[model samples]
Target: MSESAQAADPVAYIQHHLTNWSTSQPKSIADFNVLHLDVIIFSALLGGLLIFIAKKIGENLSLDNPSKLQSVAEMVVEFVNDQIKNVFPHPDKLIGPLALTVFVWVLAMNAMDLLPVDLLPSLWTGILGLFGADPSHVYLKVVPTTNLDTTLGLALCVFVLILAYNFKSKGPMGYLKMFLFHPFGKFFIPVNIVMTTIEELAKPLSLGLRLFGNLFAGELVFLLIALLTLGAGFSFGLFIWFPMQVLLDLAWLLFHLLVITLQAFIFMVLTIVYLGMADATADDH
Candidate 1:
């Protein structure tokens, strides 16, 4: 939209910032075919960046005198490993690395919220405009965790791991039996099946929604704060509102650093707990 138009409509400004740059226009709000390009791009970039950093750090390993980056990396690995040991004492070889990746990746994506809301999107819009694309049509949301598709995609991966662990711990027949005779035993098979199904489904649902809701709300607050200077011209309002806007943004940014880290930790821990539960045999249960 034109600057004046956006200034006149605060809702449009907020909506423009919230919308994701996608491969195609969605038919409805929940169109599966509508691929969110921004989320995929940012997520892949962040993952690749992490892998690159790890590889570089590994190649430069020096026990005699570790670099600051290497020291930080070791601390993160130890922290994640400690969390895994707490939940799954006999965790699989993959669990430690997986938990570390999830925590770091989620934390990195969540950290995108700390960026100025208009920075990347505005830069992207300018680049697209140079290529003859309409500036108004350019919507780039940097934080992947704020997108439901990204969060649910991560949750579904955990769900698959849960299923795999269950099948490995118990044979197929034993896993099936869990659905049939869980709480009340085979006497209440029907009720048991229904209850077990809901319980199983809720794991991924909760994981995805919890992460998405928190990040989305945090992003929304940043956007709302951005709106404070929306139409503030070179008048008395600009001086009054701009300082307040800066103060609010700084306060929220400090608090959100904790929120992002905690959210990542929560997700990683729950993943470990669920996988640990899946490893339990019928007798253990």
Candidate 2:
């Protein structure tokens, strides 16, 4: 009935956190649509944090010895800027901020996984229930990348950037010419168009899947570790289970930290690469 009651049942605690705030019925295996509010809220908050951090950087910048914060910010800025500079070639006044945002925002969002997974969700859910809403519907997965909706939304944003840069760097005719003639003869225009379309479609798919799959699996592994403390102890014996469960959770979490960083980097780098591709010139080919 209450959290104290739920605390008496480990199975229910983890199960409640894992449950989705979905509208669909579980008719089959495919009936899963994890209504992940944590991902959305975390992403937006991180995005806002990125902008604020950027503003602070801009306000406090100096040529003398930099503060630790400024140095860290500069390192991230330069890293993203170097990647964009290498790929895009055009020194646009606008693209720099967007690219920097991608790098920082994603890094922040991915960093959420470093928090004790259930702590924030448990806190927020309790807070929500105080407002008279159903706490179950406040479903949260702290790692935004764990949700298909968030990752796909991010990938789609990158896709839109590609389109924007395509239009900005290449006129309508140039963009069309890219689809019609880049890889082969003009006679193969139709096939080329279809191939190019598929390639474009694959960008978001790859981006989304790469991030989503990694984080989702990582989350599941943690859930599995949580399960380890369950029936194994009650059915077998506590002596045989608790030690292995602690070791396994620690090891899995340590490994997942690397994975979360790698996935975030991969996603950001892909975004920059796609943006760079959009800004490519006909002469380069």
Candidate 3:
């Protein structure tokens, strides 16, 4: 859109930015009517990028005069291994790599927020227009972590690992005993069942919602900051908003760098903790 068009109705522009590139319109809150193409595309691209970088670093490793990329890669691997050893006492062969993947993938996804909000969308819209699609309808959201489905999907994958470890460490009967007897003993088996169910369910719910809520709020704030720069038309007074906008934008962006990294670390740490908890045998439970 032209500057005049955007300035004419900033609300519409904000709404357009918020919209997703989906397969179709959703009919209801529970409907799975449309797939978020933007999220899928960005996520796949990031995942592929991670794989490519890892492969390149692995193939180029040198003990003598290591490259910066190799050094960073080793550092990341060592950090994740230490974290896993600390939390997951009997760390499985898969745990270190899984934790590393979660940390890097999430950090990459969250890093998308650092890009100018309108950059990808405007570029995508222009490309779509050239292909005979309506530029106005080419909504694109580059941040996959900000999408609930993506976050929840990650949580669910962790949940499955929790279940697997639970079974592996405890066996079926012991697992049943975990839910049937516990904090209240055999007399309170009914309460034990209900409480245990809720506790288990809360893990994934909290995991997904925490990441989604934070990123979604950050994305909205960026949009609002962007909106502050707009006006119906040019005026001498408009210059006054620019400095405030610049200061706020820089401050928030700096703070958000910590937020993105912290969130990714938190998610990785919690996944290790949850899996460790699941690894508890009947005796420990």
| Number of the top TM-score candidate | 1
**Looking at model 1, which ten-residue stretch has the lowest summed lDDT?**
276-285
- Which runs in model 3 stand beyond 4 Å of their true positions? 1-6, 281-285
Best by lDDT: 1
Q: How accurate is candidate 3 locally (lDDT)?
A: 0.88
Model 2: which residue pairs collide? none
lDDT by residue for model 2 (26-94), tens? 465344454444555677788887778878988988889778889988787788788776766578786
Rank candidates, lDDT, best first.
1, 3, 2
Per residue, candidate 3 scores C-alpha lDDT tens digits across 209-269 of 9999999999989989888776634776668888788898899999999999999999999
TM-score of each model, paired residue for residue: 0.97, 0.79, 0.94
Clashes of 1: 0
lDDT-wise, the better of 1 and 2 is 1
Q: How much is the lDDT of residue 107 in candidate 1?
A: 96
Candidate 3: deviation at residue 2, Å? 9.9
Tell me how far candidate 3 lies from the true structure as C-alpha RMSD in angstroms: 2.0
